[model samples]
Target chain A: MLELGPIFRALLRNKIGAILIAVQIAFTMAIIVNAVFIIYDRSQQTKRPSGIDEANTFYINSSGFGDDFDIKGTITRDLEAIRALPGVIDAVQINAIPISGSGWSMGLQTEAGAEHDGQGVAVYMVDEHGIKALDLELLAGENFAKSDIRWRGPAGSKWPAKVIVTEAMAKRLFPELSYSEAVGKTVYINNDEPMIITGIIDKLQAPWVGWDNLDNAMLSPEKMEFQSTRYLIRTVPGMRDQLMKTVEELLAENKSRVIDGMRSIDYVRERSYRGNTAMIKILTTVIVTLTVVTSLGIVGLASFSVNRRKKQIGIRRALGATKASILRYFMVENFLISASGVVLGAALTIALNMLLVSALSIPPLDWFYIPAGMLVLCLVGQAAVFGPAKKATEIAPATATRTV
Target chain B: MLTMTNVKKVFRTDLVETHALRDFNLQVDEGEFVAVTGPSGSGKTTFLNIAGMLETFNEGTYQLDGEDVSHLNDNQRSKLRNEKIGFIFQSYNLIPDLSLFDNVDVPLRYRGFDAKERKKRIEESLDIVGLANRMKHLPSQLSGGQQQRVAIARALAGNPRFLLADEPTGNLDSAMAQSVMELLKEINKKGTTIVMVTHDPQLATQATRNIFVKDGQVSEINDVVAMHVANG
Candidate 1:
């Protein structure tokens, strides 16, 4: 502790250089820590919007010539062939898939002759097996069956406005209605007569890294009469890709419906979040590089400053300073300067984070960056001190006797 | 005790090689006060530096307190110098920003002594130099004589084997120089070997013995060395 006074005094003797080094440290830390925070935010959001049971699901898009323009039967035949493939998992053909390239938007009103005040939620006209293939749970009603098509109108029928809604959308449609109350109530979509809200399915969270994902409402194909360009498939473990290929070939062989290439639900979800994830990667790289450079600069400048004090170090040596002691003296001085810089940087990162929030759609600060910034600074100080402190220790006491 | 026999130091540059000491020899036992004097570039400073283990000679064995320091590393030399040598320079070399007490405390801190022990030694040594009450003063605040005294206090705090001074009184006025000389004589009487190098013939006369070097070689001249000391 007694040794600290002189080391500290020596560092303080050059206040400008010390403060500048600290500033460099702080600046790099701000970028580095925030970059980490941004990556964490990306991960959370990527996993946030997923809805499908990613492990069990795959999506097949069929887009080509159908028999004299009958895309639905063409789609249905391909779906059947895919289901029959080896490692056969249950599969279904649906008119509309969630987050599909095509979806219809219309007003959904909950009472008779209502003026269609609110727009309808995304509605997938699916079969019983499709819901099961998706692992969707019915919150207040039974799952769809192939038999339900007899009770409902044609696919894409101007239904009396009833469709499933997410738990969140249900709350929005009826402020006081509980999830149970929203069920069995008649809602009008596109100002047509009201359709009953059959069942609410849970919202989906997509994966961070693809294209086969849906996160909204599903309805019986009997209610919505219009068919869609999407086909959803579920295959047994490891067979989904092969089955997808077979389905495409079948669609081509039948000449009734066109078959699109195969992709898992994982692919769609990954695609959904790729933009943000890539951004995070780029930003983190930039911040890390900046931090490393800043730390190196601090170390280099500190070494130079300590070198300039060689004669003083020599005087101290002749005054009975052990070489190790002198080495420590220089090292401690560098650490002190670095610590001050880190503190300043932490404060600045907070301030800069506020500015970033307003300027762009950036994620919030993450937890990992704080320690990473400090570690970078420490390594910088230790590395830089090697040169200057070694030079400092090598100063011969004989220098003190000579005329400087 | 300090002893050197056949001490040879050669300085070499890329273009020129110069031998500063050619077969030099000197010996001083415990409590001996010896002064080294010579004309400009006479190797007085080099010999004194070698004696203090601050510099090593090229081709001779120099012993300080019965140890051969010829092959020791820098750290080893630093430790030996710290534990056994006191240095007083013409410039005083007090860290201007520090208080007298802190200056005295500097070397002791490097010795790895505890705070209490270092403080006690600093106080005692400051008192011995009659600067106990002024320990709080800065070197810049003190007169030249007082600053040199603080430098001595700092050196003495190490309890060194000997004091190697390069023109200890060179920067002082006549009275201040006399006072510093008296302090050195008193310090020598207390059993610390003192080897002083000086250009001042008058001040050089106060040592118990004097050695004159001409052209990197020492020659003992009994009558001439005495006359030089006696005239002052």
Candidate 2:
């Protein structure tokens, strides 16, 4: 039988230590739950697919410096040579790589005029071979034809009439229509320039992984006529590393151009999400450290309580308390304290989550984390108090008769 | 109601072996109030502890209410102790944080009585000890005599077959000690057996029988009286 009534009354009289430990537990729970939630949230974000064959693709930047360097000619020649290599599948000169953390964005509206509300979209400048070179699955509409490809000079301002948008971008632009139905729709870029949505790709992330509209992107059918360009190359399975070296060497053969910043999509992704990875590691350490410190605090308090009540425990033992009963007594007492702490912790968890949601604009915490944290902390408390409580049982029943 | 035959208790340390009890023998019938007196280190307390089942005896055949308890496990001993034995300590060992009622409720709780039955027993025992009205007061709020009375109430709450008290009135004044002695006599009159160990010969004279212990064995009354006179 549990002596809950007597133990509770006893705690009521001597509660300063229990209250301090309980408050410590409450604060630890609040921080741990929130930190775990943030870690989960960030890890999920880092796992989002960038809609490319990341394992078999890479990109390299080439900049020609002298007057004899042919920007357009060199790009065209380099594409032909790279595509014709043994392991190369397809290649395209892209303006920006997906999830690379830097790119161009523009506003597209359904109707004309600057006063009309528009949605933001990251812009990828690729030619007719963009779909195969980037491994994009065209969900609806047709791919761009060779004749549809346009060349834009450094001083050019004309917008392409045909553009392909990702399914997410199509949904944002025309929420009333399905992705397939939005294929032939016309959207106005730069407020008034008419651009028709020629196709819808299944999934593609924008250049900025941290953006709220990470999946909202459009592919314009254009090749740059500038001094610097990046070539996105996709190789056959198990051939990316070999092709990366070959392509870098081939591009380096051009004396007027410098080949630099050659990287695979995997490296780009790692660099992009480094902040999130660091945050996860730091929060995990904090949670572990807080749990250890809180457990130690519980051990300290329980050991002190047992030491102070040695004579009382002996008297109880002499009165007929079995070892198991004595063990249960301390366990139940710790449970009551932990239960109170977790109850307060639940409120604090939700409150902290609310503040984070308002301040950081992240989603509100999931409801299940509160209960899970409470149970874990309770188990930790019970485990921590076991050693001291067991020591209490070792006190001789004869201690009650000792005058000292 | 209680018997011990050739009980031996040896206290061994790294460098010393002290015999607390050797070839100890004692028997007390039901409803008898027996007082044991001895000088310091005479093993009087050790005998009380062994009799109460608080400490185990080596090389002994012990019977309490006709049950052989020499080979009982610790848990079995604890159950028998809880069900059949009551103890009062020299210091009036009431848990300081618990009120009179709650302190008295400790053994009954271990006895597995329900709340109503426990409450009834607690009130009745406290009434017997003349502290029922002060049941809600903490032990620290009471005087020394009142605390000892609370301890007695706790011992009587379970209605055990025997009470083992080690110097029950050792910490009280003369008036309080006499009052507690009268209470014990009244309890003995009600047919509960009691075995008390004390150093006070005046207190020992009031028991139905008095036994003196010297050098871990019970000695004669004349020898204890002569030793008492010599010490004085």
Candidate 3:
């Protein structure tokens, strides 16, 4: 009601100051929004699923038992021993588990032609019953082979002749191909020899979450060497601690590997969370520091504009204008600066988001953030105006009357 | 109406004390055109500042339109000044960043008038100054005389009880100054009490009454007698 109302005109008056404010706001917003999304994703990764209970599971790095031991024999013997132990519910030997997100990558060049630049897919290898053990769903086709599986290739650097593909990979590699077409397709994976796709499994968990999932390739145990390191053991209620202690006792002679240093799948997943959390904190501190600096810059500029207008303000004051009216005038000017900065910053942020997605290969700017980002900028701009507006009011009308 | 009786204003710094106004007294009845003339350091501006409630005096009994202004706080003083006083300055002091209409509207905004009322007041004020068609033009686009007229319009828009002019025509050429002098005379005849401080002897004599300040106190001399007294 004093001259013009608060919102619209306030931001329209000060152009550069408003842009600086919005840039700061957008900077802070980019970090804050990115941080929140990262946290949410990490939480989703950490959330416990119903099938294989992580809390009641016992895992061991079997390769830690010795440098040159038969991993299969050791795994078979330990699993039996673990199952026989008190409170141990189930023991299974698995070649590789996927939930830790680390999947073994191999080449996938569409046997037709390797045309494009090196874009390769990964293939995961696991022994028999690993799927049932991890409680993963097989969307199409059967699991890996039940008998001995082997691939005789160059330097023996190969997995089994039978494989499984995740649904995402199935879509990418096959697309319109039926399960039966996919089952017999010679997929070039670990062995340099084409292996028949025995099953199609929806991606459960991998070393990374991705749509392409280059490591979406799967290998059965018949193709592996006689050794493996990791073991995923599921147990019944309340027997988790006892089961872990027994595994430690078994590896106690070799000691160091299984001591307090062994990392579980849960630890690995949380490591990713910690990684993103650090990112959030760093980016947030940077954006906040810059926002403070920008706000100070805007307020400084606004103060100058007000000081220069002192005589005019004094004239207005003498002409029956109240201090509140003068205060609103300066504040509205600041709002203009803020609003302009916000709009430009919004566009700038969107442009920056494009670079973030294209160059850095991070996610694009989510549309939901624009309005929220602007709101933050508007608030910051208003704050910048506060000191100067009050100063403008303190100017006396008699100041203009002086022959300056 | 404006009255000042035995007002004293002292300025002090660490160890130096200077008296700007000592035993200053003057009175302006309704509808009087009064000119205050003085040499530098004679305290004419200080008297105006005190009378306009722009500066505080160390000791005084001062009243404006029947209210005691000598003891008013900053806000109260501001309220009194806004409600009762209008000003025309030598420099015009028009807002460089605002248009003519907006410049006139600035004071009315302080008075908290609605848009329709403020617009009407602004147009009428500009019309009185013969610049109604040029309301959208900036002060920079106007000549000094025109800008000064806008300043007058600014003061007039508020419709204050009294008008204060500090060297209002000092910046204008002689021909423009006479026109402005005529404008002031006409405004005075319309019943707006005007207190003008001028250095021009001719302009000072044009007022109905004149006061000359010497050193730190008021000195009385006839309009013609004052010039000869200063010149001699």
Chain A: TM-score in each model: 0.78, 0.98, 0.72
Tens-digit per-residue lDDT, B121-217, candidate 3? 8899899889999998889999888998998888888788888998899899998888888888888899999999887878998887788888778
lDDT of 1 by residue, A14-122 (tens): 6888888888888877876776677777676576644656655666655554335654455556566766777656766655444334454455555546544764456
Q: CA shift at A216, candidate 1, in angstroms?
A: 7.6
Query: Quality of candidate 3's docking, in CAPRI categories?
Result: acceptable
Q: Please list the residue runs of candidate 3 whose C-alpha ends up more than 4 Å from where it truly belongs after superposition.
A: A2-58, A64-73, A80-92, A97-99, A104-204, A210-225, A233-249, A252-261, A273-275, A350-366, B71-73, B221-232
Residue lDDT tens for model 1, B6-35: 999999999998888989988887887888
Return the top candidate by lDDT. 2
The TM-score ranking, best first, is 2, 1, 3
Q: In candidate 2, which residue ranges exceed 4 Å CA deviation? A: B221-232
Predicted structure 3: lDDT: 0.69
User: Residue A226: error of model 2 in Å?
Assistant: 1.3
Model 1: how far is A338 from its true place, Å?
2.0
Clash tally, candidates in order: 38, 0, 23
Please give, for residues A216-325, the per-residue lDDT of candidate 3 as tens digits: 54545543334445566666767666767776787655432344434444565556456565766676676667668867876888788777677767776666556776
Alpha-carbon deviation at A223 in model 3, angstroms: 13
User: How close is every model to the real structure, measured as TM-score?
Assistant: 0.78, 0.97, 0.74
How many collisions between residues are there in candidate 1?
38
